[model samples]
Target: MSRDGSPPAATQGPASTGFIPGNKIFNRRDFVRERFGAAAWDAVLALLSQEDQAQVASVDPGAWYDVHLVERLISAACQQLKLDDGLLMEMGRFDADRELSTVYRWFLRLIRPSFAIRHMNLYWRRSHDTGTWRSWQNGPEVSAELRDWAVSNRAMCITLLGYLGRTLELFGGKLASLEHTECRSEGHATCIFRTHLELPADEPRPGRRPTRADISSLARELAHSPNREALVEALVTLLRFQFGCSWVEVWVTGQEDRMQLMGVSGERGPGDQRRFVLEVAGRAVGRLELELPRGPGQRGVDEVLAELMPWVSIALETARVDRSEPHHVEESELARRLRRAREIGQLTPRQLEVLELVARGKTNKEIAAVLGRSEGTVEVHVTNLLRKYGASNRAGLVAMFWGEL
Candidate 1:
């Protein structure tokens, strides 16, 4: 059965009866049709039986095309255009991998919902060493139509090989070889492909130790971040540049056993890829993940994370505190105390006016109307007052002013 609980289409016969519509196939068909023109598309269809041609003609953008239909169409298009299979395979690899990297971070999520987390974890644990990565997918389990194609037109497996190769290459490894180790058509339980990556040359590599200046500059940039989101984003960006990883992501635990993606740098990968815990006072706050190429240059990743954790902890704590309620006190008492503090000298003319309205218990909107200014302007003044007074909220600002009075 497919993900939507639809029965798998049979593999051995005409695809007209078994094909299902999918976004991937729909988009591919439209692109091919537009690129090759109606005459070419009709010619490809004419290569099939009259019934199959009618089915192709009837396919709508939203409707599902049989897997067989889709595959045959691709083969027909390539043949008609006199495109080399190897060239087409490489094109498929490049286009599919590019799309998967950029716009389809959750590509596996859509296809393997049940094993998504497990698959991700597996990808992360697997070493990206040259000649290290290998994986297999049971063709029969994917779709009966795929199994049928495997049994009959085995040459079409080049498309699958290209796709798998590109997927591995996305992990910052080069494909050295990909061989079909097992095939359902050959009486194996599942189709299996073993992959090998070209190993990096063994050589003495120079260590990229972070200089004192680099650390100081990074610290300064992070410290100047105005909010937690900005701080996390800056950290992710800095890590990506420092380590030269393909991607980085920050995931924090959320309510109800969920994980929230706080920030990401670069194209998101399928799995955790590489993960380190972010702890504050020995309590886990979040995780930092990355996908890096095989090389000697990434040896400093752990040291960089160690240096980063303290800053990240501080930022997370500050954000949490900022969201919580400020210490409560009577409003009149606070206002009275502010009057006595006589700290009005700290405020500019406009800020003083804004502060007075705030002390008078006016909302930002009300203050804006009374001052004949924008609500945004009033908000800025209020924020400035809180910052200048070292206050957490409007109430705290009032308390700081009145306490001094």
Candidate 2:
């Protein structure tokens, strides 16, 4: 049974299907017509293959073929491979301590034999996986399986590579090289091929040591830092440092709305503008913007957007919850006096002042000045008194208290 629990007709055994130079048979126009309906094959070939390249060479850039055909081809390949055997999954065990060379050999015998690889060689990260650099030394040898797979499914591999390339591009990387070669040893000979995706170097590690003292100091700094601006700035820096973008902006809208931009080093030309929406509890509360050259950055931007989504979601939720909570400020004589005026004289003095000011249409800042206090201080006083008497903002406070008074 396949993944969908259906019986295996498409998943026929390798031996049952005699390997006729797979590529040759599949390459025939009749095979395409029979396997995929003529119309579907034509559509896919038109968009994905070189079939239309000659005529379309003179076509306008804006009239380029729909790239989604590549996407659909890849999606179909992935779906088929999943229902059968995926090349990447077949190449090696994820957690096993496998030699890169052995893995490469296995890829040749298994995965490479199933694709129409003209030339390929695997190049890996310098040292992280094995603490040693490995070099490519062999050439590609065409096999019966490869020819068959290629003929039947060359579109799949091309689509897969494009999808993989686009995917890596999202992660600050690109598909860089592909090679095919032939190898011979002790009267044994075979074809070798491989593909490589190159990721840009990671950001330089921070110089500061994360010691106990450093952690304590950072904690103190965070405690003192203005949360919203600090958070926004940090998010921008993170996007740039992690994804290698030049400009990032976050727009937050709530009871109080704000926009913050970071990584704008100097005068800059325009870049691709992508909006990553941040949702909290399924409702969007904010968005992030990346302004950078588009070309290959689409993949990386998509990745960055995915990575930043949860962080932004958490931040927005925190902001929403925090907005409802009261602030902790040093009690002042004015606040005490106002509290007393309400209790002793059965009067809401703070309420009276806020209402009178509102009736006169005074702003929060103007009312704060009239009452000899900071705007924030005025806000808290108004908020506390309104809550105590079950009212809303200054306007609502005025409506209830003024009606009673």
Candidate 3:
């Protein structure tokens, strides 16, 4: 009986057959023929002993044959061609691509990774019934153990690795990894596979910290940015330097998902469900989205972001010239604002820090508490910003900081 409950197809190898499915043999034939050329495939066979050659040449893909034939044939090919067991891995990969029926292959491609991997046993039994397949799947991770199954060849494990790895790829995994943790030939009771898909985060991790060096560099680089595009590029480069590999972007804050700044150091997949709030003055003014590479995040990003955010705020403020901006500020608007504000006197970083608190509706006392300043000093900053923008009060001062002036 097979997974579908009917008797096994005549070509399907059953547990009693002591042989892999005959179609797998056909796949090997095709693999050798396609990869090595027709003549080279013959050369491979010629390396085998005469009796083994005769048996292999006369092999019927629909009939059961000795499993040891694989061991002998693979060994001969490797020894004569100065090759390695990577041939078997390639052969297994070829089988995965060529063996599945066209309709079934497409069906598998259209489904989710979790669903397909969870029901992997059913797919396994279709090819070999000799072993018990124990599988567990969690979101993007899957583990499968093969107990009491020996193909009489240790090199075959490499083939299985390639086979299952390609299987994950076929089902829409981009940066998936497959590893064999335990091997029966190595005296382990079962052959275990640990598979993981490096899926992007579904949402932001609040307070995710970047290092202090990253923070300092971000501010320094941004301070030198000459244009809006350059500012975004600087941020992208900073992330790549921090992560070693990353696809990072600064997306616009409004309802529109229109993107502003993006940098890709490595390849990216289609879906990226993660985004951290890019903030200024304690508001999510934008998003820091990523098409993360194939590894865990490095440690301590949030502390850096906290120090880095105000600088990013100033840079992005200069870049708010896009048509998407509801304010419809002109391309040279920030330059105009900077020039006009300077006529009232160039403001210091401490003055900008105070303005940030004012924009958040903080009173002088509240702003003092937040910035570790006296209320009197906070009141002077508010008074100076107001005088600089010719504003009547706090409300107009905040509006000028937001580029309304």
Candidate 4:
């Protein structure tokens, strides 16, 4: 998708069966070979050839390739350089200049046009002479396996780091540091690449990390939020402050599979952002999105989100229940009893299927046949239902669940 949240069709070149037209002009492999020398390039190719015979047979540097192949080649290159993941990632953080940014953007579009890559300027300090400028390169389409490999290896992303480092060098900035704060492989919906400019020694340090007390207080506030709108607002505010994000928004599934914007915080940038689904009772109900900023303090946001989502779910469910009209106003006392009984029973989904069959006057053998479970398992479900609901037998369990229309 484009950075504006539109489909790739807007920027897409002429459609072709093999490769997107004009995309073959920029070959990342060729760029690497020219930059790093022939020996390093040959070593990377040897590793790629070992992994896939097809790669060896038909090595076309100018051709558009799948993301998986690119990732494999990068992994191999990392190995050949004899650089640990830390050094490799460190190599990615170079100074950013306009020419470097333009070249990087071209390479990104050529290789992964489907990704939403945007460059944003950061406000460092009031003094313009300090030149403590920072920029961010956000890639939402990063592969999960690559992210996982980075996290497990305690390494930075080689592809993005390499592009950023080279761009910085072209801009006359020495490589300082690069940090991958958020990663899809680390349970975030997007990969955030933060670039810190090589500031002078006299420059002040960046802001301090968000305190644990601040996060805990936000969690408490979310839990106590009176309604869904309030809950959403609290969440967006907390995330924006906690992460120093460019923007944050909540999108919930409304009627007809459409997404409804619930709340937003910070400057609304282009529509391109990362989306994380919010699930309840094994069903997707909403999504949380973020346009992350170029800064620090993203290390524990995932864990914080994990801790806070239950409250968000509860608030959403409460709002849904409030908006829904009562359908059981004319229900009989026996029907109400059955409903309460089921609520108190706490049956598993499989057990509930068995209960529905029992209510249909099905025996254990019949339920086993219908549900594809063994007769023994069906018997166990029935027994648990009876015991949980204080029923003496299968008929009593049925009486607790069955009622007139």
Candidate 5:
């Protein structure tokens, strides 16, 4: 939870009772004040015991405080606020974001999740004095176990759950599965959490806005496109691949004020979504909508849309033809085939280039010439391609490329 990378003071005496950083208690109180106003936080204090009331008033952000009092304050606030218990995660997420403002939070976010899980206790220990947090990271799967952590209730556990999830978001990871498999609240001796995070190192992090260079590249690609559908496809593909949008759609407004779906990209997955109005010369031309893999937003949509204004403006104008339009643009058969082969075979970059050139009706020599590789290397790639495709020769490869026997 100390993601701000600012290590807490080591002034916590070795005490039997659990002690947490005073900043956390202060942050929670501040959250109540910011969320429900100052009077609401005062109401929360009135509900607490006299001992807790005094401690809450004089809590020092630099000192360690009793977690028991903090837990009670949380209970009273929740009861008075009538907040859904699930909002505890939201509160935790808010706490995580607040830490992002600290120096070195960026470094923490950039490290791999595996490293974070392995060394998470170093930071947790800075704030928590009574619990042993153990973690095991196996490839993409992470298992976290908390031992000797005795809390009055599960409220703190749920808040930590939200905190962990938000930290993963900052690390640019998408959770395929996250579950509190075991909890002290459930009569388990040690709390346990299981998680599977999808971190594709080759793929750009989700929630990042398109860069200026990315928009420039998209403009160049769109410039060479022959037709309206091709333009739409180019824009959709770039958004999906470049910035990790799960779904992208562009809708063009016609002369009569009717809207037409021009193009789409990526499978519609459950995630966060943003919608933007595309304008040209101050007139609304179309809408650019996209969904990112579900997580806290890393950047603003307006910044992303602004960077992509050049490509979006051109693509929108090109797609406004409104003639012989399909629901969406489809990739060429051969391009689709090449992409399918690349994915299915898990081809290397060179193999992908060879396969694409071959599908484009290039011979091994021509592929070598195009790729700046020797004919023998191209032949080796072609042979591997034949074996992967279950084809005997180059001729058979081409035939199978078109779904022919």
Candidate 6:
């Protein structure tokens, strides 16, 4: 100020203007966005790894199985990738096997991230050099360890594929596909899976993270569901669509800790049963349970369930209120007397109009204007209608209307 002008008139230095050293401003939003993006990427990787491990664990290499576990895993994964509304539809084991091969092939072509895939090639060397399917001897090079690892790896691959497929499928509409190819060589079994990865030009990209408003809207919708049955139905619908569960049920607790069946959805397997307890506001309200597939998880479904828990608790509280006993009512003698008077007197239309207007706290002049009649006419109508209504005055008429309606 001293250097540039006559007076230092309301001047801001470099620090106040945010141009000085150590004057940096941090934005919490931008920081959170960066962190969330990183976390999502990490989660995707972890899920892929976990699914692979699950598939591998389900295999027995020594057994003469017609269908490979890896193939099934891939199929389940691909179906999951393509599913709509985060639902896991029921598919047989055989179908899952077919799907794995399909997803593996598709992923190679479309979403070909730099990942290695090992396909198992098995063969039997006959004790005699006879080229037949039967009477095969163990080859010198193939050890038990190798065989076990192959089966395990295949299973792991399938599991990984199932989860991956499901995750992608939830997003909808051809973001990926699966293809499979197997080759038979001289004396060994070999399956070469060429997963085709296709990243189409018009393929949809990842969407923006849900805002607080979006979460709030979903919560409100969940809360506003009409009744307990409707709320339980919503929960069942969520499990079916999201987790691909076989069955779901909800229970509400009443006095003396007795449980009531609130709602049930889907059918369970033979002799299968499960249960969960629901608690809200430091009190046990109800429970939810479901029968799930003994396979890789559908995380999208789990995520949604976790998000809905608070809303679910809120719904239970609402149900508790509805379950309470209703208010008591007994008609007083004065109420009875009014009804008798109204029946005895046949009040005119004008009188009825004036009576209602007076009960609503309008003056005679106001009632006359509303009815398009003279104030005197309105007064007379009031007198007659009051008699017809069997009320002593405006107060009695209001009470009578409240009781009858």
**Candidate topping lDDT:** 5
* Model 5: residues with Cα > 4 Å off, grouped in runs: 1-16, 202-405
Q: Which scores better on TM-score, 3 or 5?
A: 5
Better of 4 and 6 by TM-score: 4
Q: Report the C-alpha lDDT of model 1 over 75-123, residue by residue, as the tens digit.
A: 5655565445464465456445544633233222122221321133233
What lDDT tens digits, residue by residue, belong to model 3 across residues 1-405?
Answer: 111222211121223335665667678778877877888778877766677678777887777666656655655555445444456667778878876655445444333355445556656766675677778877667788887664634556667777887776665556456677778766778898887865332111122224575455446445544445445544654554443333455654433434332322222455332466665567555566664444344234444555676777666655554313443222234334443454455766466556645765667876676555799988888898888778998877767766654
Tell how far residue 148 is off in model 1, in angstroms: 9.7
Q: For residues 1-405, what per-residue lDDT tens digits would candidate 6 score against the true structure?
A: 111212111111121111111100011112222434545323322333454445333434333221222233323333323322112222222223333343233322222121111111111120111122211112111111122122222322233233334433422323233321222311236433222233222121222322333455445544644455545644554454434566666666645666655554444654234455566767777777777655444454445555666677777667446545222212223323433433555543334334445655678776665445788876777776666666798777677665663
State every prediction's TM-score relative to the real structure: 0.34, 0.23, 0.43, 0.27, 0.46, 0.26
lDDT of each: 0.51, 0.39, 0.58, 0.47, 0.65, 0.40
Off by over 4 Å in 1: 1-23, 26-40, 54-63, 74-88, 94-101, 105-152, 185-189, 198-405
lDDT of 5 by residue, 1-405 (tens): 122222222122233388887888877877888888999988878877676688878988889887777777767766677555366677777777775453324334333455557656755765788888889877688789888874725666767777777777767778876667777765778888787876644122223345544455445445544456555654665566546676677776654656656554444557778887877767766787888765455465446656676567765565544434553444445445756776778887567667766876777777666555899998999999899988998878888877742
How many residue pairs collide in each prediction? Answer: 10, 25, 7, 2, 0, 51
Worst 10 residues of 4 by lDDT: 121-130
Q: How close is candidate 1 to the true structure, as a TM-score?
A: 0.34
Q: Name the better of 3 and 6 by TM-score.
A: 3
CA shift of 331, model 1, Å: 46
lDDT by residue (tens digit), candidate 2, 1-405: 223423222221122222112222122233334544577545534443353334223333223233322223333334433323233222212111122233223222222121112112112211111111222322222221122121123333332233223322333345455433322211223323345645332122122212222333322322222244444544554444434455555665544334322112111236566677777677665677766555654665565456546656566456445545332212222323433435644544355455445544567787776555689976776676567667656677556544553
Best model number under TM-score: 5
Better of 1 and 5 by TM-score: 5
lDDT of 4 by residue, 259-377 (tens): 66665434445533556777778866678878654334444655455566765665566556654523211223332443455567765545655665677577888777655579998
Ranking by lDDT: 5, 3, 1, 4, 6, 2
Candidate 4 global TM-score: 0.27
